[model samples]
Target: MIPQKLEVLEQTEHKLVLVIEGISLEMINALRRIMLTEVPVMAIDEVIILKNDSPLYDEIISHRLGLIPLKTDLDVYKLPQECECGGFGCPLCQVSLTCEVSNATNAPLMIYSRDLKSNDPKINPVDPNIPIVKIDKNDKVIIEAYAILGLAKEHAKWQAVSNVAYRHYPLVEFDESSLKNPELNSLIVKMCPEKLFTMSNNNTLKLKDDYWRYCTLCMSCKNNSEGKITVSPKEDVYIFSIESDGVLEFKALLGQLFKIFNEKIDEFITNLEDLEIES
Candidate 1:
């Protein structure tokens, strides 16, 4: 098979969209699964509650902490299971975060993930606004959290990508000559939920390309058009989109995913060679 061609349509720190050609759906789905489940990220793994005067139990607070997305540096850290410390605990595998709060005001004070102090400067909560718990006036809360490098397969908190999906590119065909009738044009425009159809100055139906991506393939336009319009999917090309969970940049996540893919391919080739040698 020929190699697939990947053309990046849009990219940002948190989101990416690409057009991939010459690839099968099964191969693309495997990459999506790996990005969602195999990507390594940092998240709170252990909690040591020193004090708790709030209504929430220690386990509840710990769960909240674990869900918070932490900044990850793959180059500087190692997965806990792979660390040389034997998984007991080490600076290379874990980070310590401490949160201490004593509400002195009359109003209820909200504790947020930003309140947690991390021993490592590089690993911290991605969103400071994530509320951990609410404490009434004169209440106190203290806790120690241990953040660790892990894979998303172990827990959702470690998932690097928030979403990964792909779909066939949309193809819309409209017979403008047949849509010259004002009544038919009005009907077509009215049937489109996305408002994709509009009337041109020449009194013919016009389709907007901007709304094509949001097409639901409901066949309303095709059904109402009476052979004036048709919609289909471009089977050979796919529109792919990915969303990051803030632990790693979208580009960084893609780089790591490609690295993993190459490694897996090499390992498969090596195993095949070994099997042939044995035969």
Candidate 2:
């Protein structure tokens, strides 16, 4: 039951770094893959362009709209396929966004995400300033789009997170006594691309105090040090980092990941139980 533990190494508005222990490489990778594909986020899937006066075509405008990230409320919406409306347009599974812009000024006007108003106040573009298109004076555009909760498996625009990755925690081994030449020590310290190593006041190589937090395990130091340094991955430990595009909060993303993970496990167990096997 106590198979894994996790600690946050760094946290920011758009990025998170974590140290995970007691988990196998396979398990950690599974989590990453799920976050990249299975978690659902709201994205524009259907568009109705009633009028267009801009230089961009209707299809191009639709594509641009699909890529805009929208704020998601996991509790308030359901995936279309899983909705009680049987994937039909319904309040529970879809939100409508409309954009109607007319350039009255003499100068060219740029259409922004803020120009599109959503029927539901809870779901709108994450960034108000994302440019959709530019229209000349007297140009008018009218559009209606539908946003629905979907998985990245269907389209990348629905992906919940970006830069989802995990790497093994690095372990560096070396002895100062093995290398007598100061020149070699200097080379070893300079070879690390992450700058994880530094020369101490006594002319010995020293790893940074929080090297584990930044080490990429590139093995640059080990390769150039002529066997004086050893760099390898520590077993059963990993560093995981994920970046968000602000569509969904990190908390919501992780919550959705576990919910989907558990459902898969339960399904696998039930299928195995119902299967007949020859002894």
Candidate 3:
């Protein structure tokens, strides 16, 4: 069995960075790929326009609505194909959101995502500021849309995360005595783009203890120090980062990631046993 270690370097509502150790490069890359395209999220797929007094065409308005990211509840909803309703419209597979806006004031009124009302109180747009259209005085706009769980591999609207990537774990090695030139040390300290270096009390170059969290392994320090320093990536370790649009919380996203990973692994093993290949 392969040993693995996971550590969180940084986490926020919409961003996460992790230190993944003891995993092969191929496995880590596969995880990144799955996170980008396989994770499921809720997005508007169908739109009905009953009346449109806005300047934009019906197609443009529908397209904009389709791109709006919606908060997803995996426990409450299932992918349409996987639902018991067999891809037919049902509460377990889809949610309806409707917007009805009329401008009675003299000035043009803007319609935002907040105007849309969802049948399910739990599911709503990730951001309320996303503009759908604008209506002039005495004009009205009405729309009905359906949100469903889907995969990014089929459409980008269903993508749960963005900026999903991993980089090699970085290691910087050097001896203070070897970096004798004060000017070189100062240059090295200042040259680091991530500010992972500093000057020590002894007036020599000092590296940050948690440099791996921010280092891009650019080799700038090694080059600036001439032959005094060396920079390299550690084997079987990676720094993984993910950015989200508030579709899924960090805990849920990671949970779904490993779930898909294990499912694929189990499927592969079962299929392997059925193969009749002879060596």
Candidate 4:
């Protein structure tokens, strides 16, 4: 059967939210952890292609980190001459911006790293201000932004400047006892083409949160000739929030859509495999 891509459920300048109808927070958090960590942090990742629509097309991979706008490295942006504190307070090394987030119940709070900003000539921020958003609260949303210039990795101070993304899989939950007796976890493990399923020493089969990034959501894991397992996506729980300086655009919209698509494809593949095994 031909697979179908769902329509854009919702969009925003900095976020895109969707519903998968019966998933779980545990599963969603699991998927988020994997996608955020495993997705590649390519130096140049985002590609914006303008089509017939005013918003344009923003294609993205969960693994793809933010783009490096500069063609060269940071040395080029440094001030040529020396300073009183030597390298301290150099104008070439800093830029400032603002960002704010409000009532982001559906999405997790994320911020960019400031230190890694590339010195490449082509690199430029659409907004000179940085991301400033409050997380998980309402009534007078939180707002903050400071100079986004630095080069340290893993330091919280460096995080003010780079865009990061979460994993793309819809949260799915299943009751293994709903399948067959002695629920064969091996059946689910074998169903994954991505090798996401694993067996524990205890002999109980449980879905690894890390594997969510690879989940095709094919529903093969759901197939139980003996009626022992039940799996479903959490669609009713919808959460939407984004914080950005500009108006909503395609990059933000499509980037999120791709994440949704990745999970759907996994589901389709898994479901198809499960059905085949039953047949």
How badly does each model clash, as a count of residue pairs? Answer: 0, 0, 0, 55
lDDT (0 to 1) per candidate: 0.87, 0.91, 0.91, 0.39
lDDT of 1 by residue, 102-209 (tens): 999999999999999999988999998999999999999999999988888988989998999988877889878877888778888898898888897788888886
lDDT, residue 89, candidate 4: 37
Q: For residues 150-230, could you state the per-residue lDDT of candidate 3 as single tens digits?
A: 999999999989779889989889988888677888899888999998897677778889897788888889898885788
Return whichever of 2 and 4 wins on TM-score. 2
Query: Which wins on lDDT, candidate 1 or candidate 3?
Result: 3
Q: What's the lDDT for residue 74 in model 3?
A: 94
Record all residue pairs in model 1 with backbone atoms less than 3 Å apart, i.e. clashing.
none
- The positional error of residue 27 in candidate 2, measured at the CA in angstroms, is 0.4
Candidate 2 on 38-111: residue-level lDDT in tens?
99999999999998999999999999999999999999899889999999989999999999999999999999
Quick one: ranking by lDDT, best first? 2, 3, 1, 4
Alpha-carbon lDDT of model 3: 0.91
> How does candidate 2 fare on TM-score?
0.96
Which residue runs of candidate 1 sit more than 4 Å off their true CA positions? 1-8, 11-13, 274-279
- Residue 172 of model 4, lDDT score: 51
Please give the ranking of all candidate structures by TM-score, highest first, separated by commas: 2, 3, 1, 4
